[model samples]
Target: SDLPLLCQHFINNYNQENGTTVKGISNETLQLLTTYHWPGNVRELNIAIERACIDARKGIITVDNLLRFTQNVSRQNISSENYRGFDIKEARKEAEKAVIIRALKASNNNRRKAAELMEISRSALYNKIIELEID
Candidate 1:
C-alpha cells in the first residue's frame, strides 16, 4: 500500500544522503503497480523495493525486480493459484458437505440449532443433507 512506497522512498533518500545514489522508480512501473490488484499486499511491495534497491546502479529501477519477485514466489505458491486441474464443482460440493457434517456434529445432531449457528435455514440444511446423502 501507501506505506511501503513511502518506506521505499525513505530508503532511497537515505541512500542519496549517504552518496550511494539509489535509482529513481520509473513511471511505467508505478502505473502497473498502482493499477494491478495486489491481494498479498504490502509485503510483496517490500520485497519488490528491496530487490530494486539491490539491483540499482545507473539511476533507473527497471521492472526486472518485480519479475524476479514473481518468479520466486510463484514456485512457492503454485498450489494456491491452481487446484492441480481437479474439478472445481466436485471440490466445492465436498467442502459444503464437510461444513454441514461439522455443524451437525458441533450441535450434537440438533438440526434446528445447527441451522441457526450456520446462519442457514433449517429447510435448506435438510435439502443439502438429502442431496449429499449424508446420514
Candidate 2:
C-alpha cells in the first residue's frame, strides 16, 4: 500500500522542517491508517500524517496521535462504509473511550469534574476508566 510510503515521506518532511527526529509510525498506527477508508484519499492521508507528526512524541507516531488527527479532521467525513467490517461493540467501546479521554482532558484529569461534564456519576466514570483501561 502507498500509505506507509506516504506516511514515511510526510514524517521525513516534518523532521527536516522542524529538526525533530521522529523516527517512524508505530505498527498499530499504521494498521489503523490502512483500515481507514480515506474518503478524501491521498490529500487527507497527507494531512493526517502531518497532524500526527506534529503531535508525535517519544520518536514515533502512535495510535493516540492518529486518533487525535482523525477526531479533529475526519469526524464530519465518517461514513457507514467505514464500519463495513468493524464490530459494533468494538466501535462503541472506542467511541466511549475517546469521549472519556476528551472529558478527562477538558477537566484536567479531575474525575469529579469530568463526570459532571459527562453528566455521569463519579463512580460510574471510575468504572468506565477501569473498564476502558485508560491511563
Candidate 3:
C-alpha cells in the first residue's frame, strides 16, 4: 500500500537529518502500521515515523518499535514499574528522568529548548542530565 511508501518517506528524511543508516521498516512493522486507523492522519503518521526512527535499533525499525505508536505514546514513556517503589527519592528520580526525556523528545533534542520547556535553567538541565545519566 501507499502507507509503506509514506513511511519510507519519513524514514528517509529522518535518516538524512540524523545521519542514521536505518535501512527501512521491517515487513512485520509495515504490516502493523498499515492495520492502524491512524485517526490523526498524516501528522500522526509523521510522529510515529519519527518516534520509530528514534527507537529503531541495529538499522531497522521493528514491530516492537512501532508498538508505541498504537498506544498513548506519552503514557508509555514512564512505565508503571518506575513508581512501584516506596522510596520517594527513587520515585522522584524516575519522574524527573521521564520528564526530561519527554522534554528532550518534544524539543527534538535541543537542550536549550528542552530546559525552557521544563522551566529550568540550562545549567540546571545539564546538571540534572548528568545526575540522572540521561543520554
User: Which candidate leads the pack in TM-score?
Assistant: 2
Q: How accurate is candidate 3 locally (lDDT)?
A: 0.72
Clashes of 1: 0
The TM-score values for the models, in the order shown, are 0.39, 0.64, 0.51
Model 3 alpha-carbon drift over 4 Å, by segment: 69-135
- Error at 77, model 2, angstroms: 11
For this target, which candidate reaches the highest lDDT against the unseen true structure?
Answer: 2
Rank candidates, lDDT, best first: 2, 3, 1
Pairs that collide in candidate 3 are none
How accurate locally, in lDDT, is each candidate?
0.58, 0.74, 0.72
lDDT of 2: 0.74
For residues 7-120, write the lDDT of model 2, one tens digit per residue: 999899888998999999998677767766777898888888888888788989976676555653323322221233456466546656776788799899999998886667
In candidate 2, which residue pairs get closer than 3 Å at backbone N, Cα or C atoms, i.e. clash? Answer: none
Model 2 root mean square deviation, Cα atoms: 7.2
Q: Give the TM-score comparing model 2 with the true structure, all chains together.
A: 0.64
Ranking by TM-score: 2, 3, 1
Off by over 4 Å in 1: 1-10, 13-19, 72-135
Candidate 2: where is the Cα deviation over 4 Å? Answer: 72-89, 109-135
| Worst lDDT 10-window in candidate 3 | 73-82
Counting clashing residue pairs in each candidate, in order, gives: 0, 0, 0
Candidate 2, residue 123: the lDDT equals 98
